[model samples]
Structures are given as C-alpha cells and as structure tokens.
Target: MLLLFIPIGIMVHLAEQLGKMQDNEAPFNEIMVYLGNFSITIGNILLPIFLFLSVIFFTSKLASNTEIVAILSSGISYNRFLRPYLIGATFVAVFMFFMGMFIVPNASIGFNEFQFKYLKKGRQDRVTENIFNQLNERDFIYVSRFDPVRQIGYNFTMEHFDENNVMEYKLSAANIRWVPSDTLYRLTSYVKRSIKGEKEIVETKRRLDTIFPFQINDLTPVSYIAETKNLFELNTFIEDQKRKGASNINSYILVKYKRWSLPITAFILTLIAVAVSAQKRRGGMGVNLAFGILVAFIYIFFDRVFGTLAEQSGFSPLLAVIVPNLLFGFLAFYLLKQAKR
Candidate 1:
C-alpha cells in the first residue's frame, strides 16, 4: 500500500510543482531530496488513517467469514477478543510517538527549504515587514522592513534601557546585513545616541561590522520553523522565543501540541475501527470501508479547522489538539457499546 500510495502522492505533487521548479531551474539532485522529504512528511501524517482503514478492512473480512463469531462463541468474552487488537494498537502508538517526535522534523527542514528556494522563489515564507522583537528585559529591536532571502533588514533600531526603565542608548542603522562568510553583521549608516543627565552624546559611522545579542532568525522566524525542529530542539526553541516575546508564539505551541497528540489519536482511531468492523453485516467490507473513509475525512476536517483557529486566532493550541480526539473518543465508546450488544 505504501509503495502504491506514496508514488501516487508524489506524482500528483510533482505535476503541480513541475512548472515552478522548471522555471527556476531547480537541480535534479536537490529535487530528489525534496521528493524524499515529501514521502516522509506525507506518510507520517497519514499513518493513523492507514492504520484505521487497514484494521477495518481485515476485521470486516474476518467478520464476514464468521471468524469473529467463532472466537466469541468459543467462551471468549468480547473484551478478551479485543485484547490482541489493543496490544497491536499499543505497538503502533509507540512507533508513531517516536516517529513524530524525532524523525519527521528533519524531513520538514529539507522539504520546506526546497519549497521556498525553488518553487516559491522571491516570495518570503517569513515575516518581512515592520518586525519587532524583545531580545531581553532591557533590550528591544525593530526593523521597518526585512528581506528574508537576502538576509537583510532596513531602518533597524536597537534600544537599551537601564534598571529604572530609563533610556541608556539608542542605535540606528540604515540597513543590517548578515555577512555569513565573515561571521559578523554589517550595519550601514550606523549611529548611536547616549542619554545622560538630560544631554545626548551622538556617534556615527559609515558602516560597522559587529555582533548583537540576537540572530537574524530571532526577528521573526519562518512560518514553518517549528515544524523543522525535533522534540528536544522544539521545546528549547519555544522557551527561547517566548522569552523574546515573539508575537506568533501560538503557532509554535500548536506544533508541539499536535506532535504530543498523535499517540492518543492512534489509540482512538484504532478502537473506533475495531468497534465499527468487528461485527458481520449484510453489506460486508464495502460498507465498513466507506464508513471508515467518511470518518477519516471528518477527523481531518475537525483537525484542520481547530489548527487554523489556533494558529490564526487566539484560540488555545492545547484545546485545538485535544477537542477532536475527545469527540472521537466519545464516538468510540458509543460504537463499542453498540457492537457488544
């Protein structure tokens, strides 16, 4: 199923992205990397649905053959008959926990970077205008505009305050560009003003190559930055961004919550699938498969809606991850009761 499904997904994506890739003359080797990352990201996202549908398919077949009836008739309680399925679900949940936490984030880096570099050339994936960040309690920075691809910001200002919230010095620059080769920041038209005793001491320079407390990415990270960090890195990154008072912090927290929620989702969908398909019916596997697909789409819909709300609005990210799983958990319980009867 993976061989067939993954190839089809790649074909569809390649069709849509081929024009942009060709126009940008994307290298064949780098394109291969993107396709590999695509496989990892897409497959991981679809893992729970695949598990649900596969279980329903096989279980429905067994039900049609009276295999499930034999097990129940042979003095095994319904709950005991469910033990193996539960064990299998436990294994899958653990596997998915590790995959979502450790493996997929690296693929996201390759995938998203290639997307912005080739298909979305000249379009910034990060915030690019009127950026502001509080580096620490006493230091703040601002920029009138930024160009992510060029790694430069215009009309940059850095201000420092004393313990009493009094202005100590202010630094302004016409432009700030990261000099990657030199490992330093180049500030053009640099000027500094020191305030003391109601007098201002001014200093100016044509250009200055120096270091600041913050990195370029600290200004406003790429929209998908959180998706590119592993579990450990993501937690640390979130805390750092929070300290900096990043305005889009919710989006990062949403990623963290979703990763943590995948295991619970696996268990919920597994139970629901077993409950729905373990009993023989007139329509057989076809009916079970169709219903499975419908439920899968509904799950996807709820997840997307809540995720968008959390990322765009002020809705809680934790609730966004939890609410859908809770709804499905209730459905599983109802279906399990009906199936037992």
Candidate 2:
C-alpha cells in the first residue's frame, strides 16, 4: 500500500504544483494546505486499488512457489484455502466503510474548499435555475434566477393552496432578498391576490417584510455538497433537496448509495484477485498483474458510465451504483470456478 500510495501521491502533488506554477503566483501557505488535503484524497481514492494489487501480487507469488498446490494436494478444500483471504478482505472492507462513511467526507470538505479557494476562484456555487418546487403541504414557490452570493432571487412567485388543492392566494415579487439580521425576507414590488369564494382581494406594496418556509441555503448548493456529508447527513440532505424539487437530487442520491456500494467492491475485487492468481501460470506474476489491471480498468469504466447515466439521464441511482459490482461479482465466480478445475 505504501509503495503504490507514495508514488501516486507524489505525482498528484507535482501535477498540482506545476498547474499552480503556470499562474506564477502560488502562495506557499496555500500550496502547503493543498498538499495535506491532496494526500488524504489520494489515499481514499487509491485504497481499494492498492488492496486489489497487493492481493494479486502476493497470491501469484504463493502460486509460483507451489505453496497453494501443496495445500490443495493435502486434500483441503479450495474453499478452506480461501478462508484467510476472505477474512482479510472483510477487515479491509470494514475499514474502508468507516472511512467512506465518516472520515473521508470531512476530508473531502477541506479538499474541495482548498480547490475552490485557490484553484477555481471564479467559479460560482451551484444556484438553482427555474426553481419551482413544493415549499410544503400548503405552499409552492418559483423563482427565475437566484444570486447565491447576494442571497437574493429575482422574479419570484409563490402560491398558497387550501386542503382541496384550491388556490387561496398568490404572491409575486420583482425581487426577494434575505435579511440575515432579521431572519426574514424583503420583497420589492410585492403583490398579493387573495381569492375568497367569489370575491378577489388584491394588495400591492413597494416593499414587504415576510417569512417563508424555505431559506437561501436551499437556493444554492455547492456541487460537492453530497461528497462532504456523512451517511446520515447525506440522507437528510437528500430528503430536503427532494422537497425543493432539486434537479441535482440524483447526484446526491448517487453519492449516498455509493458509500455502501464502494466498500462491497473491496470484497468483490479480492475474490477476483484470489481466483485469477491462484493457479501457477507459465508467464508468472506479470500475467496475473496484467489481467488484474485490465479487470480493474473495466470495472471503473462501468462504474463511471452508469453513474453518469444516473446523474444526467434519470437512471436509477441504486442500480447505477450496483451494476458494476454485479458485473464483477459474476466475473469473480466464473474465474473461481475455472481456477478450481
């Protein structure tokens, strides 16, 4: 793990430095901060890859030395020989799960902050456009555009409904700005129309102070908001975003489901490594390593393809997360069956 991790980390660090150097104004403190964040992010991303390589490398060595053959020749079942590898994989999966669920989310927060603060200075937070969603059981809201930095929205409209789904009142504003000091909203050119059975009551004001069920935070969310939240926090966030009819809700759901799915990948990869490298090959460890890399690349390709489908095309997020695992799981079983023969 250290051997692979160190070189990968150094390469990433150097790439970041080269990019920053092109700007010719890389601050020493900023670079230092980025280095710390880069290391953690790299470690988290590469942990499973390193574990897969380690299993294949060592197991191939054992097969080459006839150790596996010796054990099998003693009448011990193939399944029995796999116990230790399974146990080790289980331990690795647990550690990875904990990191993915708790530790890495916080690290991602810092890593993304550093990137936005220094690397992506001009990019704006993701502000919802054409925002139309249910504010609650009794209210629905719409806005044409929202300025995240200003905590304001333009061309805002809201509707209040009765229990029978009858429109009771409608509110319109040329602009709405959050007043943080008062914890309320100020609407400019506000207009309200109330319907009372067969009568209509209209009110107009140049400016109005009021409160709503939603807040400015709901108007603009960072792109990596899902990445920086733990499992429970992610669940709560997804629910809140869903209520707001967020277009990027699938992205958040993808992240939440992937937290559990990624850990299971360790076990699946371990099985494939053991199965593929258990037999003595004429080309030795090189052949095993090459095959392992090919399988890993394909697995990653599937994961990215399906995840993109979920994020952009409204595919099922849960299935997007599990499809790669399912494909590789079948590959593992097939390889194991051939290895036993």
Candidate 3:
C-alpha cells in the first residue's frame, strides 16, 4: 500500500509545486508545509481503499495457492473462515473512526488554512452574502457584507421583536467592526429606534461600542468550518448554526454524519474484498485485483454522487451516507454466498 500510494502522492505534490513555481505563487517553505499536510489528510481518506485492496491482494494470493481450500476442506464453514478477516476489518474500522472523529479535523483545518493563505489567495469565507438570519427566538440580524479577514461588517441591522412578532426596536449601523481588544463591536453611524405602541423614540450616535448576542464567528463562517471541528464540537456547532438560521447547515450536518458512515464503509469494503477473492480462480490474483479495483472505484463513485446530492439538494444526510453502504453490502452478501457455493 505504501509502495503504491507514496510515489503517487509525491508525484501529484510535485506536479502542484511545478505549477506554483512557474507562477512564483508559493514559497518552498509553504510547499513543504503543504506536502506534509496534504499527505496526512489524503492518507486518512485513502486508508479504507488501501485496506480493501490489501485484503483482496493477500486473500487472492492465498486462494491461488489453495490455502483457503485446505482450511475450508477441514469442514470449516465460510462464516468461520471469515473470522480473521472480520478481526482485521474491526481493527481498521476502529482506527479510522477515531481518526475521523478527532485527528483528521485538526489536519483538515491546517491544510485548508494553508491552502487559503498561500495557494488560494482569492478564497473568501462562505458566510452567507447579505445575510438575514435569526439571532435568537425574538431577535434577527442582517449584514450586507462581512469581511472575514478584517472582522468587520457593512450595513448592519438588528431587530428585536415582541411575542406577537411586532418589532420592538431596530438598530442600524453603517459599519460594525470587532473590537477584539475590548471584546465588543464598534458601530459607526449607529441609530436605534424604539417602537412604543404608536410612538417611536429615536437615538443616534456617530459611533457606538456595544456587545451583541452574536459573535465574530456568527458573521464569517468559512465553508469548511464543519471540517475543522471534532465530533462533539461539530454537533455543538451544527446546533448553534441551526439556531442562527445558517444557510449551509445541511453541509455541516453531512460532515457530522459521514464520520460514522465512512468507518462502516471500511468494514463493508473488507467484506466485499474477502468474498470476491476467497475462491481460487484460473485467472489468479490479477483478475481478483482488477475486479477489486473496479468495485472500489464504484464505491467511491456512489459515495461522491450521493454526498453531493445531499449537500446540493434536499436529500437526507443520513440516507446519503447509508445508501452506498447498503448497496455494496448486498453485493458483498451475494458474492460471499456464491463463493461459499
């Protein structure tokens, strides 16, 4: 696995470097940093593929050499023969689950940060443009533009409503800048209007410093914010974003659900690989390998297609993660039955 992946990874990285070097866009130091980050992130994603192929490659060799035949001839059931494969798959599954739940989030954050800073200078945080989102049960906010790098917003408005959904007060500002030193916002050209039944009282200020319920993060959420958070943090973030009426909440939810699904996929791939390679064939290990590669690519294709559908459309996130697994699991079962026969 390492033999195959390391060369491919390095070649791809070097190709990227060649392009960036010709343009003089990235420094050698940044290239090194990116190489490290890219390798780790890519490795995590590729682990299941490597494991699946490993099972097929070794198991095919065993079958070709008649080792599996010898073991099964001793009156051992195919399910019994599956015990060691299950054990190996369980080990890989647990490791992958833990990595996705904890380790990969940090790596992803760093990798994306480096990419945005050096490789993708034009990248902007995906905070909703001209956002009009619920701040709370009785409050809402609107911002025409939020500059994530500057931590500032232009044309900000906050409205507080009564239980009857009537506006109680409305605050408007030409600009709002985060005062990190004091942990408040400095609102320029601020105006507040309070509605008391039929009367309205107005207050105006050239500049006002005040604290609002919303934080800087609420204004400028990067698209990959969900990828940076661990499982617990991601759940908390999703809940908070849901409360805020975040537009990209579905994508966040998808990321959270996929952590579990991908690990389960590892197990399913193992099953399919073992089932496909367990029977000795005249075509030998090469045919089994080719078949395994085809199945692996098909699995990835289904995963990406369903995942994109869930992200772009109104499809269920849970179902997006589960559908590919279910389809391939049925394939695994059928193949295993045939192998047993």
Candidate 4:
C-alpha cells in the first residue's frame, strides 16, 4: 500500500507545482509554501478514503491467502474478525469528521489564499463594480466600487433600518480603507444622517476612522466569500444569507451537509468492498480492485449529479447531499448479507 501511495503522492505534488508554475504568478519559494500547505489539506481530505481502501486491500489479501479460512476453522465467526476493523474504522471516521468540520475549513482559507496569489493571479479576491450586501436583520451596505488591488472601497453607503422597517440612520462615504495601524477602517468625505419620529439630524466629517466590530471578511458576498470558515462559520453564513434573502446559498448549504456525509462514505464503501471481495473466487485481487474502483466511481458520479441538481433545481440540499450515501449504504448491507450466505 505504501508503494502504491508513494508514487501517487509524488504525482499529485508534482502536478500541483507544475500547475502553479504554468500560471506564472508566484515565485518558486512561495509556490513551494503553497504546495506544502495544499498537500496537507488534500491529505486530510483523502486520508479516510486511503485508510478504507487499505483495509479492503489487506483484508482481501488475507482471505486470498486462506488466512481467513484458518480463522474460520478455528471457530471464530466472520463477524468477530470484523470487530477490530470496525474499531479502527470508527476512529478514522471520527477523526475525519472532526477534521472536515473544523480543521479543513481553516486550512482551506490559507490554501485558497495561496492559490489566489500564485495561481489565480489575485482574481479570486477581486471585487469590482457596485456590491450590495445585507449585513444584518436591519442593516445593509453598498459600495459603488471596490478595488481589491488597492484594498479600498469607493462610494460606500450603510443603511440601518428600525424595527418598524423605517430607515433610521444612513452613512455615506466617498472612500474607505483599512488602517492596519489602528486595526480599523478610515472613511473619508463621510456624511451621517439620522431620522427619528419627526426630527432629522445630519453630521459630516472630513475623515472618520472607526473600529468596525466586524471584519470585512465577515460581510459581503457571504457565499464564496471565503474558503476558510469551519462548519460553524458556514452554518452561520448560510443562515445570514438566508435571512438576507440571498438566492445563491443552495451550493453552500449542500457543501455544509456534504462535509458530514463524506466521512460516512468510508464505512459504506468498506462494507461494499468486503461484500464484493469476501468470498475466495477464481478471479484474483485485480478483479476485486476493479470492482471497488467501479463502485467508487459510480458513487462519485451520483454524488456530483445530485449536488449539481440541488444547485440548479428545486431539490432539497440535505437530500441531494445524503441520497447517494443512503442508496449505497443500503446496497452495502444487501451485499453483505449475500456474502455471508
């Protein structure tokens, strides 16, 4: 298994570096940094799958060598042999679940930043013409133009509405820029107006810098805004987007659910592998490996199909994310029963 994975790892690493080089963006040192970070990210993502495949390969080899027969003859049930495997698989599943839910999200942010800088040529973070985002239940922000290159926003406006759905306060500025020294934003040519009941008040300032409690990363373009938020962040963002009446949150919702579902796939696919390869057949491991690959491919295909449908159609994100797992889980159980007989 190590022999098999070593070449695969080398290939993946080389491909990642080569792809970055082709982009002509980052220097070799920066590219190496990005490659290292990405390798760790992908490794975390694929570890459970690799472990599942390893179990199947080793278990099938043992069976092919008649070791399984020896154990069976010694009065040990097949189910008993599965105890250790189950324990190991459970550990892997739990580890993967937590990593996917927490660690991967944070790593993804750095990985994506690296990609944006070195491979995407900074295109990923670009914010162009007028952008509007509903920041909260009663507040919305608008920017006429934002230049990511300059890290500045122009013609910015923030409107705060009261519970009665009436605009209570409005702030407009000619420009806003992050003042890293103070860890706040500085707004220039700013005008602040307030209307309460029948009274109106206005305030103007040449330059105003305030500590905006929220990070810029926390606002606007809620979805596809940042790749570095954990499940908790993603859920919060999804709810915020939904509350803001955003229409393109389906994909994010699908991803949020799919993160939980993907780890369960290890158990489902492992069961399928055991069922397909448990009985000693005239055909060798090649046949079993081929069958495993085929099943894995089919599962992946349907997963993509459902995911795309969820985004394009009216399908529920939860169902779309989990249906493949459910279908294959049932199939695995059926095959396991057949193999037992």
Candidate number achieving the greatest lDDT relative to the actual structure:
1
**Each prediction's whole-model lDDT (CA):** 0.93, 0.86, 0.86, 0.75
Is candidate 1 or 4 superior in TM-score? 1
- List candidate 3 stretches off by more than 4 Å: 21-30
Q: Candidate 4 on 1-341: residue-level lDDT in tens?
A: 54476558857767766766666746678666665666657777566456656766877798799887788789988788667777777887898888888877777776777666666664746436667777677888878877665568889899999988899999999988887778889999999999988999999999998866456543445234434668778888778778766556787788788788867887887777777777777877777777777776787688889989998888999999779999998998999889777
- Cα lDDT tens digits, model 2, 1-341, are 75667667778767865675447566777667667766766777777778898999999999999999999999999999999999999998998898888988888887887777667766765755787777778888888998877888999999999999999999999999999999999999999999999999999999999998777767667899999998889889899888877788999999988888867899899999999999999999999999989888888789889999999997999999888899889988999999999
TM-score of each: 0.96, 0.92, 0.94, 0.81
Task: Please tell me which model should have the higher TM-score, number 2 or number 3.
Answer: 3
Of the candidates shown, which would achieve the greatest TM-score relative to the real structure?
Answer: 1
lDDT of 1 by residue, 1-341 (tens): 56768899999999999999999999999999999999999999999998999899989989999999999999999899889888998898899888889899989999999998998887879888989888889999999998876889999999999999998999999999999999899999999999998899999999999998778866878989999999999999999899888889999999999999998998899889999999999999999999999999999999999999998999999999999999999999999999999
- Pitting candidate 1 against candidate 4, the one with the higher lDDT is 1
- TM-score order of candidates, top first: 1, 3, 2, 4
How high is the lDDT of residue 269 in model 4?
A: 73
Residue 90 error, candidate 2, Å: 0.7
Residues 1-341 of candidate 3 have per-residue lDDT tens digits of 95689669879878765665446567778767767777778888888899999999999989988999999999998889999899988888999888898988988887888777766667675764697678789998889988887888899999999999999999999989999999999999999999998999999999999998778767758888999899899999899889988777788998988888877888888989998998888999999999988988998899899999998999998899889999998998888888889
Question: What is the TM-score (0 to 1) of candidate 4?
Answer: 0.81
